[model samples]
Target: GESVGLHLPTLSVQEGDNSIINCAYSNSASDYFIWYKQESGKGPQFIIDIRSNMDKRQGQRVTVLLNKTVKHLSLQIAATQPGDSAVYFCAERPGNMLTFGGGTRLMVKP
Candidate 1:
């Protein structure tokens, strides 16, 4: 089974800091990986994505690094802000379906 789950659901960070969220995946063959940020009551929005062929990908203020050797993945947020506080989840396309990670909640402190 190819599933992604977070080690923690809630993370607290100062208004102007950096945050790192971790995720564990169950499949090494999953070719497509995506990081999504979900606010309070909305659907997950795409932040960044990486393919099996690559080990790293970056976006505006986000970076996704994948380690297929251990089937592990991580997301790093630079300059964490209040608006950057949200739930982050990872999804992988294993077969025809997308398996999503449990999700990590981030809290920004001022």
Candidate 2:
């Protein structure tokens, strides 16, 4: 049995536009955070990650921001594309286990 969690559910964006996905975590002791993108029928793929010591980090076309003060995390995608359409999830690593958010579905309208 899994505990209840928070999630956004879905998000829609226009192609070529930027997309912002937000997440909230409960563990104040979490030190590592990761963002993943999951396509239909596929496993969650790594997007970007940030540490509790850092406020922000960036990847190829993605950026992850962590606000430990508010226990919040956010991901920003540049030039949203149809190929980018997927479910995005945030994970917090507390100790040796990882807890994941419900996820946000990103739809890119072409």
Candidate 3:
């Protein structure tokens, strides 16, 4: 079985600032890792993703990074807004099934 978790349970950032969410996974052989944003009462939505071969990948206003050496992954969101507030986590596939990580809540303050 695979397991993943975040270093911090909650993070508070001022509106318009950048936010970085960190995750650590136990499976080093996972092929792909995805960052997901989960809003209240809603399922997680894809934010960005990075493959095991790539060190970093960027999207519109977000970036995903993977460090295979340390089995760490991160999601960075630019210009944080109230709308960006959510529980951020990751899903990794070490084998056939998807293993989801514990979430880190992001709070944006005006």
Candidate 4:
């Protein structure tokens, strides 16, 4: 079976603050998880990744927390800015295939 969908997106926050988004997955065998950010009319850019063997990983101004038991992941962005406003996606890379979740839009109030 195939898995993918589209949904409305909206996130508004004050500038220089932080933001967090959540995701849920159905596949338990998935091993790798990645967070990506995409701007208007662009492809998803890699932000960070975490393996199923671990529970947490952090990157510049970003952190990813994974819960293997629940099949969930989350991304935290520090110092949200106007330039940071964009759509964020979470992808699960199992084997040679990459499965993407519907993105969430982030808005930074200036």
Candidate 5:
């Protein structure tokens, strides 16, 4: 049978270091991808995004890379900090709805 979904449930990093979180999306037709960060009790907040047409996108201290060939996406954070510790998720927009991955917990050690 063909695979339908993908997820990564955890990640860890040390303060002042770099962190890379990855996700594999199942939809080949997805045109939009977003990376979100959710603190302990807060709603998911937009971190960065990349369109299907683009391979990579960058924001302040953050970068998102999309590899359509492998149906994979990754988020890279520079200078990981304590406050940067959170649960991060990748969402894919296949059409009108967004499918979210299982989320990776970013642990920042001091």
Candidate 6:
């Protein structure tokens, strides 16, 4: 996954509303995760993500939450905007392997 310091991707919402994107992995040992935002033609841009030790992390307008019990991950964006329009996906690191998820398109209305 992009969590390996590598790729690319968003969710749709109103300009002033909050957006949440989620992912689930089968491996419980996955310790590191990353959230990526990929624009139309660009590679995935790292938004906010971190190690498994923390239950939650916040970056700028984005927040990431990890639920190890269910092996789930989520991203929360506050006050989403048109510029935030893009594709979003998550990558989790299980040992030396990086797994990426299918991305969701984020379209923000004016």
> Please, what is the TM-score per model?
0.94, 0.93, 0.96, 0.90, 0.92, 0.86
Q: Cα lDDT of all candidates, in order?
A: 0.89, 0.87, 0.91, 0.83, 0.87, 0.79
Number of the top lDDT candidate: 3
* Highest TM-score model number: 3
Which ten residues in a row are the worst by lDDT in model 5? 1-10
Tens digit of per-residue lDDT, candidate 1, span 1-110: 44788888899999878899988898876889998899989999989999999988888888899988888889999999999988999899887878998899999999
**Tens digits of lDDT, candidate 5, 1-110:** 22224355777777999999988887888899999999988999999989999999999999999999989999999999999989998899877977887789999999
Model 4 — TM-score against the truth?
A: 0.90
Report the lDDT of model 1 for residue 77.
94
TM-score of candidate 6 against the unseen true structure: 0.86
- By summed lDDT, the worst window of 10 consecutive residues in model 1 runs over 1-10
Candidate 6: count of backbone clashes, pairs at least 3 residues apart or interchain? 9
Model 2 regions more than 4 Å off: 1-7
What is the TM-score ranking, best to worst? Answer: 3, 1, 2, 5, 4, 6
lDDT of 1: 0.89
- lDDT tens per residue, model 2, 45-101: 988889999999989889999888878899999999899999998888888987898
**C-alpha displacement of 92 in model 4, angstroms?**
0.3
**Residue-level lDDT tens digits of model 6 in 2-67:** 332111234457889998887876666777998888898899999987798999999999999988
| Candidate 5 regions with alpha-carbon error over 4 angstroms | 1-7
Distance (Å) between predicted and true CA of 41, model 4?
Answer: 1.9
